[model samples]
Target: MYAIVEIAGHQFKVEKDQKVFVNRLATEEGKKVSFDNVLLIGDGDNVTLGAPAIDGAQVSAKVLKHLKGDKVIVFKKKRRKGYRVKNGHRQALSEIVIEGITASGAKKAAPKKETKKAEPKAEAKPAAKKAAPAKKATAKADDLKKIEGIGPKIASTLVEAGIATFADLAKAKPEAISEIIAGVRGNHVTDTWPKQAKLAAEGKWDELKKWQDELDGGKA
Candidate 1:
């Protein structure tokens, strides 16, 4: 019998005693592991397919070893510019051998129930409560990279600091925006960021584009 199963984030067709190399798992060598994400199973002319994943189905395997795969080289360069970068990476991998497959009747383990102790409630006292300030409704975040000076990292930083939408950025102080993204790489000029955001928030795309064409890296 053969079964299609999902291991880590990848899928594989496996059978009894078959060895497979997959993404690195947290299981130690010689440890047994079971996967419940059985997609399909076949035996002779009989076959069973899952609606996504089979219910009450499981595949068992034993982790053999963990190791790194072959290194891959990554290179980048900018044309007409003296910019070049080179890097290499190796993927962590694990080796495992299929032990058995259960197409059905493999029930999931029931979660253990925790017992909680009851606590006594305190007596209430009569007192006047102060009204809490109403919170402003949150707006959906905009793509800050649409602004000339903002790159992916800077955009992410701004979103992290609560400057998400174009309107929010338009209301932000340039000096504060500069301070917020000070740790990010490159010398970013924030002089035109608010103006660009203001134009974008006001739906003046043509004017924003024309103004951006005249500016360099958000500097007027």
Candidate 2:
């Protein structure tokens, strides 16, 4: 037989000899606890569900151990401004083993195991073919590369614009994109950017030699 019981503000269907992890309870390891508020019960073909909790129905479980979950890390940061933050956390948990359900809403059967006969082995099937390679994921619109005059300033503007990923940068607006790169070094230098962005959008990097030569000549 199996029954649904509420523990640690959560509901779970438990059966004989099953182990479960839940919120830390007041009971200690090796101690037995009986849940009087059973929400549902089932035996083979018959099933019963409770309104709030079943009447006189109870399920018993033994506290096996107390444990803690894996550590989780949280992080936050702000660009150029140099602001950063990080933290970690862990959750307490209890391990319990289901004992049995009583017919009179009390716990009855003893928790134990008996030897069983050996079962026959089944044949294994051949492995299936490998799936096709997935397409390259698209990145952001503000890809700094798409802005006409941008260089590293394109990257800086993207970050400042909150365009962290290529997918995000790909969605940037021209005016908004311009504003993000406004103060960076190259951006402050004559606006070689909007053209660079346009070149980037058309995949015309190979044709920029004349522009590069003119830029080199000016630097000389």
The lDDT for every candidate, in the order shown, is 0.74, 0.56
- TM-scores for the candidates: 0.48, 0.44
Candidate 2: segments with Cα more than 4 A from true spot: 77-83, 103-220
- In model 2, the Cα lDDT at residue 206 comes to 76
**C-alpha positional error of residue 21 in candidate 2 after TM-score superposition, expressed in Å:** 0.6
TM-score of 2: 0.44
lDDT of 1 by residue, 1-220 (tens): 9989988657899999999997665456899989877877877866766545666689999999877678887799999999899876666667999999998742221121123222111101100110111112233568899999899998877765557789988988787676567556688999889989999999999999999999999999
Which tens-of-lDDT digit does each residue in 39-128 have in candidate 2? 778788666654445556888889998776677777889999898888665555678999998646432121111132221111011011
Best by lDDT: 1
Residue 79, candidate 1: how far off, in angstroms? 1.6
